[model samples]
Target: MGGSLVGRIAAVALTIGSMVCARIALAEDPCLKQVFGRYCLGGEVDPLLQSVPAPAVSQAAADSLALIFPDGENQLYVLAFSRRIYKVVRAYGVSTQLRFDDTYRLLREKYGPGEDRSQFPEYASTPAARLAAIRRGEGRAVHQWMPSPTWHIELSWTRELGISLSYVANALSASRAARIESGL
Candidate 1:
């Protein structure tokens, strides 16, 4: 009976330790600290719009609004649903392999190497070749990092979209989608 009691106490201690460790690991995830300019995921949209220069265009949908700002050689899109910002994207017009590589390196350095979801044909061996393939609609490059269950960041390049980095709040996005689906 004494040995069994000791073993039970050890098991409880182990469980508590694992819970604490899991919390610590979550707290240390750098992706949770991701932000777009001065805007953060799940932040109010009005404040962010006011802080930035007036957008070049604004479009309103049923449950969401999109603000597009032309910033230098890039375009910034802020998408808000139910007055809260859920997604932000920065699109680069001048897409180049070097530019994409530099951005990829910076993101990897900050958030660790994200899951590379790029689809390249076996024939596309070199970086330039891959870029050419992307331009020709033969392939696309995408890397994504999900820091937590609630948010993710994606960096992608394609012929039509060029190069873009997106920050998304998953929970809010899901809520928006549900609302749209139900015609609410």
Candidate 2:
């Protein structure tokens, strides 16, 4: 009877130790508390909007909104249901005098090298796959960073779209992100 009790206690201790190790691993994320400009991951949109200067309507979807900065350097997108900042897109344009290189340099300086930097031209078979691809920053070219399990930053360069930076929420379902991205 005493041997069985000791075994159960040992099992419980091992489980607790495993949980602690998992938490430590999660806490080690380099950019877990990092922010982009004035915004951070998982932040509410309304307050951020209120704090910043008014933005131009770059695009308005049925359930999402993309607001461009006055300087035309960046775009902010917010998801409807949660009203959270879902994506921050930076557009490179000669007229706006924006350069993707500067942004790339800044990101590297801030977060160091990303976890994955690759591109896959093949289209995904399903919406889920598409979202996964997007999350992985898989496209014509991709530079991706996962600051935390809940947030990701993807920098993609394509012939059609030029170079753009996207900060996405990983916790949200791929379907939901697809819907928001597509404005469906």
Candidate 3:
């Protein structure tokens, strides 16, 4: 009986240790690790970002960003100018009912008041618009995919403080030749 109890405790401790390590690793964004609570500089993510601090985006504005995404197959991209973790691009067959803030606010409202920050040690307060995830592009070429709603949301950031976000949909077929560049 004594041996069995000891083994169980050991297993629980190992499990807890593993979970902590995984959490830290996931939280370990290169841009954030070096800065350590500093504001982020807008630019291609680099080693020097550690010295800068982060800024705050109001919940309303953050929520509103989601609205810009069009309905009925659209593309949406979020280029995090000041924060790299917030940057992402997703394009998919969007439903007409698709709206941005609906999903985000629910996460916030659930937390209630006086919630401890440590419980959600994540630096970015932004809520996912629609099951968001980090995606790698194919080589140097801008990556493309159909996550839902939009067709394409090309995203890139500068070393300064600018993130380019664009929404595109209902374009020519994929095999068709479509090549052009425009500025804002």
Candidates' lDDT values, in order? 0.84, 0.59, 0.32
Q: For each candidate, what TM-score against the reference?
A: 0.71, 0.52, 0.24
| Alpha-carbon lDDT of model 1 | 0.84
- Tens digits of per-residue lDDT for model 1 on 1-184? 9999999999999999999999887654323334654665676677656665787898888779898888798998888888777888999988887888899999899889989999988999898889889989998999999877888999999987899999998988899999988888
Per-residue error (Å), model 2, residue 39: 2.2
- Sliding window of 10 residues with minimal summed lDDT for model 2: 27-36
Candidate 1: misplaced stretches above 4 Å?
A: 1-34, 48-52, 120-129, 179-184
TM-score: which candidate is best? Answer: 1
Estimate candidate 2's alpha-carbon lDDT, on a 0 to 1 scale: 0.59
Positional deviation of residue 161's Cα in model 1 after best superposition, in angstroms = 1.7
Q: Write the per-residue lDDT of candidate 2 for residues 1-184, one digit (tens) a residue.
A: 9999999999999999999999886654322233446554444556655655766554555545555664454444433224555566564543111454676678889889875565554676564554456446564456788776777888766554466777776764364667767766
TM-score of candidate 3 versus the correct structure, residues matched by position: 0.24
The residue-by-residue lDDT of candidate 3 on 67-156, one tens digit each, is 122324543333332223233333334312133233223423543321221112133243332122111211111212333342333332
TM-score ranking, best first: 1, 2, 3
